[model samples]
Target: MLIRDLPEDVVMEILSRLPVESLMRFKCVNKAWYFLIRNPDFIAKHLFWATSEKRHRGLLLNREHEITRTPWVSLHSNETLEVSRYVDLLQFFPRDVGELVVFGPCNGILCLFGVPADRNGPRDGLVLWNPATRESKALPIIQRPAEMPTTFPFRFGFGLDPKTGDLKVIRILNLNFRRCQVEVYNLSTDSWRVINTSVNPIYRINSPRFPSYLNGVHYWLACERGGPDHWLMLSFDMSNEVFQEIALPSLTERPSFEAVAVINDSVALILAYNDLATRFYYICVMNESGEEKTWTLMFTIGPLLHFTRLIELRDDGFVLLRNKNGWLVLYDPITQEQRELPIYGDSFQVVSYTETLVMLNGSGECA
Candidate 1:
């Protein structure tokens, strides 16, 4: 009747249901447990349970010098938001790496990028980190094209291929005003390859905003190269390694601001319209992924005094918003209530993440 005497399947079922923090500690109990926990099949099953049961539904706040994790709870209710834990970047990375910019939490792996303080030093700014496991892998150095401009803009996105179970990191570098260079890094191969693709001249990926990964695709809000006159949704399929453009709903007046986030397993677009006379924000959700006509306005809030950005639309029906001051605020679309979260930090970035033991190499085995 002892636990170790149980069948392997039964042990796996029990272990998979445990939290990641507990599972990490349990791995040290015995060599058998260690191997079992590190098995690729076991890791997948554990992640399946973790996501399906909503075991680790929380907010990953990227601060100036640290990354803080907190539970996303109802603001109107008695539930309180507290920092469950955090990781200091300086402890794991050198300060001379410049400012750390986080890319994604695709399957619990965060893609980080930073510029080296010394231009002559190493340029391998890409780092893949798993907060739960505290394990990280540095990607190979990226070669700067000789034709690159002095101040070119670049953005990074992370995604997982469901069909092949591969983790891919995509970097879109704007070579010039009209040209873009695309590069994709495959975790399974541990190599970076340039994608020979041409982007439309009228549309450009907005580098200031992060891309949303859902259903094996990464989505970004693309606008007219220099102005906000036109907007479109750009999607990249990780499995096929292809890009597709989806037209957005036409607006009476071009939106002054726009952002995209994943809401309720669908793509949601937050549009803000401002003029000298009035200003308003609209929350539009597309029930279907690629269907442009499905874009319906869910709710409209405000003619506020300040400009606000949409951080996320939580599962509990609350929207995480950030104001001009960079403070975290929770807005309930149903109740139409707004309140500030107690997390005090400058330059806030939030991402909806589920805790998992997914390794950076796309294999459960330790690298």
Candidate 2:
């Protein structure tokens, strides 16, 4: 049946369920769908559902003998359940791209940033891609300063303004030691505007691990340096376009291992340390300081989670990655449990959880 035969609301509902690929393809099916799909509200609705569906979905990249392949896989909700391996897509990536790969997924779109070859060479920028739909938009290149420190690392986040519904890309450049520079690009303006600001001691590029989206802002872990070497918790607010150091709750002693992530719809910091009797773990629930009250300690899981990779799952929960019988296993942190996801054929390094996708090592060629 023609889409026109369906009610307007029904048509939008149907469009929202289809992956981005089907939506883009359906746009060519008729003029009405083309106009409907392009509507900002419809795009927002599709992005909402896509992000929800992607949260539970897991992507695996298997590379062997110099050949790499990445396939999107989904995890069953059951903690101990096993699901069959499936390939959502089977395609080879172009070769000689870059050494470092970072996945910044916003809405249903995944933006890839690559590490630059040298100071004079083209720096890493944004490329929009939809895995579920396999449709992509290669963004224009943005200027990068060549004089920055060579060894320093940078962080990137893709966000949308919930107020004006504008799509933007934010890049935080951390120089050698602890210097930071913030730059924002709006798709509507197609220009890069550097924010005037100075990071206190300097923030280091923490692992791409705990960065997440909530209430239209992207939050990640950064060290706010005070003295020559001391570091504190730093947060980058994407919506209001500001950066501020957070004061963590008072603890007897700071944990040796610290991670920042979003949990239960709130920004949280997980501090872990080893004590003589048992391993100590503490979670600090975050809320705007003056807007509300104080930092609350949620839970404390013992030494069992010493070396686990803690990540916020796509399903609004969390997962712990550990080696099980030489295979990687995922455990849910909240329930204090574990499960095995059958990931095989490791040719290239695969870094992904749910919202953050994976990009294999390759030469610079559009896939």
All candidates: TM-score: 0.86, 0.71
Candidate 2 TM-score over all chains jointly: 0.71
Model 1 regions more than 4 Å off: 65-80, 117-124, 208-211, 226-228, 275-279, 287-293, 323-326, 361-367
How much lDDT does each candidate structure score? 0.71, 0.54
Q: Kindly list the per-residue Cα lDDT of model 1 for residues 254-336, writing each as its tens digit.
A: 67556777766767787888766555778788766545346799877665545566665567777677766667788876676
* Per-residue lDDT value at 76 in model 1: 20
* Residue-level lDDT tens digits of model 2 in 1-367: 8767889999899777665435657768878887777676786676567556653343433223223333233322333334424323213122223343435445544555544434456554556554544455556675556766545556666766777656677777765555567888776666678897666535564655544556777766665455423445555566678766655566667565466666646777777777664455567777675744367777665455344433333333545444423345555556767666564333223324332211111221125
Task: Assess candidate 1 and give its TM-score to the true structure.
Answer: 0.86
lDDT over C-alpha atoms for residue 148 of model 1: 78
Which regions of candidate 2 are displaced past 4 Å?
1-4, 17-25, 48-95, 116-122, 139-144, 174-179, 201-207, 224-231, 275-281, 300-302, 305-307, 311-318, 324-326, 333-337, 344-367
